[model samples]
Target: MNKQDYDIIVMGGGLAGCSSAIQLRSQGQRVLLLEQQRYPVHKLCGEFLSVEVISSFARLGILEAVRKAGAHPITRTYLTTSNGASLESELPGVGLGLSRYQLDLLLFQRAQELGADCLDGTKVNSVSGGLQQGFMVNTSQGNFSSRLVLGCHGKRSTLDLSRPFTGQYNPFVAFKGHYTGIALPGVIELHAFPGGYCGLSQIETGEINLCWIAHEKILNCKNSTLPDPLWQNPVLAARLHSMQCVRKSQHRLSQISFALKGKFDADVCMIGDSAGMITPFCGDGMAMALQSAEMAIPLVTGFLQGNLSERDLKRQYTSIWNREFRTRLQIGRLLHASFINAGIANLGVSLCDTFPALARGFIQATRGRDHGANLATSDI
Candidate 1:
């Protein structure tokens, strides 16, 4: 019944949306941050933030808060194959493991403190119009207008109807759960199996987060044990057979990767997995989600201030994202192809042992660090 407008309207209240809202509020912009779910809701995620992300957290003034909220520091990452061969590498900086439930709530609360209107249980139905002045958002609560809209709604949602373009739909499903008995590596650990890889890490509450991304076909055929036929390699099949006793808390499909385009195009900037997602094998997706908000803030702010146009904002955002993540995404894509290749996987591990620096570089790249870049190696 009432129409309240803000400088910007941010849909999805996860890490990226909250981060963007906080940044905008800090610049004295009026912002409305909406979330379909209430605070402290859990989502299926790896729960590990890489060192690159921790650095951003410190700069954003939330590192201390994250620790005080019970997040645990992880200093290293360990990777093991089904054949039992393993490689371990120290992160160039400290990483942390914390559930999305806690992390998102922390970010949301911070945004509220900074003056963003935080709306929970508000499901956005659709958005219509462009970036010049503002667009009308149709939600369950009615209509609202804002010049810029940000999508941070995670992997799957019905909001794609509001956009003009969508990318190819992937058919993979990601299942995640939290368990208590497993002693995760002091850092994030990845165990590769056929059809997919699983990330295991210890989160703040002393529980281990286990997440697996596999083909939907593999999941559908399994009766008791996960189906082996879907796995392209014998190594992945062997690993799945071994996880019989690991408990599960939640199971869901991570949406196929997609992005918004058209007149609705760059008018709305999508953040987090809503823009694009990376395989979780590297433990950098969530970090990239948060960091992307940081990178987009200045451009968005400038656009709002008339210092930059929508075209410039979109160009800048795309350029920064590509510069920062394109290579890593490409490398991840190459690695995904080998997960099912026994010869290549084995050869890869052998290579890591022969050239430790090269292995470190690969790990760094997986964590979204550019190759040959020098980032601080620390755990604080």
Candidate 2:
């Protein structure tokens, strides 16, 4: 038998890619991780972790490391509508506030320490071959072969255009920045405006992460920056006025789509946003990234060991992926759609205020089951 270059080659070294590399390596599989950018970088994200991920972090052995890096614990949520109506509720569980810059670096180092071959600053130009034939990955660093490949390159990549699962063009744009002088250490806030919403939370560095997403039309109407109506809400306005923007930490992205994404294509398993991006309002994208990595490990392991056929592996992974995240993404889309309408937005806030249980239920529904126990017991 001809030996392949690696047991697995994971493209895109963000949370999904890094975590997958670590998990696979822990199981004694030789893995290679390709990342186009260097470590400790910022990405456009809400930068909030849901409580559902605590167990996964503990299982991944990064709980302590994350805490040491200054992750702030959050237990409450505050939401406001464009009309200035507000609703507050206690979170079902404790969440964490940490920047991707810190989180990604820590995970990457852990993967390297565990013996996963990591190639930072390397971009994968193309991927070919199939499950039976193995895969030929052409990258800026060099070409390589692997029995299995995982795509975690995230939203809107050049690879997406080349793959069969290219989603429709979405006009949504997102902006994120770190700021100081806004206080609300234990609470996560989401303020809704016309065609957009903003999330503010305290990350480990003591700076507030202010991220907002909106339709391009709404932003274009408002001087092409902060939406004008966002300041109409007193709470959000005050926070915005008080924030001292961190120039170096600002990031932006355009053409974000919330459409359902294809899970498997060209014999590559998609994880994180590469698979499907949950609407940011749910604040579960980071957790979903970690969870998807956990979901991929067992299936990939079974396939590489010959206990599962390529067809079976893809089928089972797609089933598991749909089962785990489909509903949450659906809920996210519904909520996002509703919020885009001013009347529904205000009415929803009023209802949540009148019935706090409903608010709690909405939060619960958005967060899926905790699979930490399964991770703990799994050899991979």
Best by TM-score: 2
Tens-place lDDT per residue, model 2, 1-380, is 36899999999999899989989999999999999988879988888888778787777778889878988888789988878788888776678889989999998998999999998999999999888888999999889999989999997788889654455668888999899987777899999888888899999989999999888777755444466867766778888887888878888888897777888878899989999998998898888988999998899999999999888888998999899899989999998888766779899999989988888788778887772323221121
After superposition, the stretches of candidate 2 with alpha carbons farther than 4 Å from their true spots are 164-167, 221-225, 371-380
Question: For each candidate, what TM-score against the reference?
Answer: 0.86, 0.95
Flag clash pairs in model 2: none
Clashing pairs in 1: 92-377, 193-236, 194-236, 262-265
- Candidate 2's displacement at residue 42, Å, is 0.8
Where is the poorest 10-residue window by lDDT in model 2? Answer: 371-380
RMSD of each: 4.0, 3.5
- The lDDT values for all models are 0.72, 0.85
Q: What TM-score would candidate 2 get against the native?
A: 0.95
lDDT at residue 201 of model 2 (Cα atoms): 96
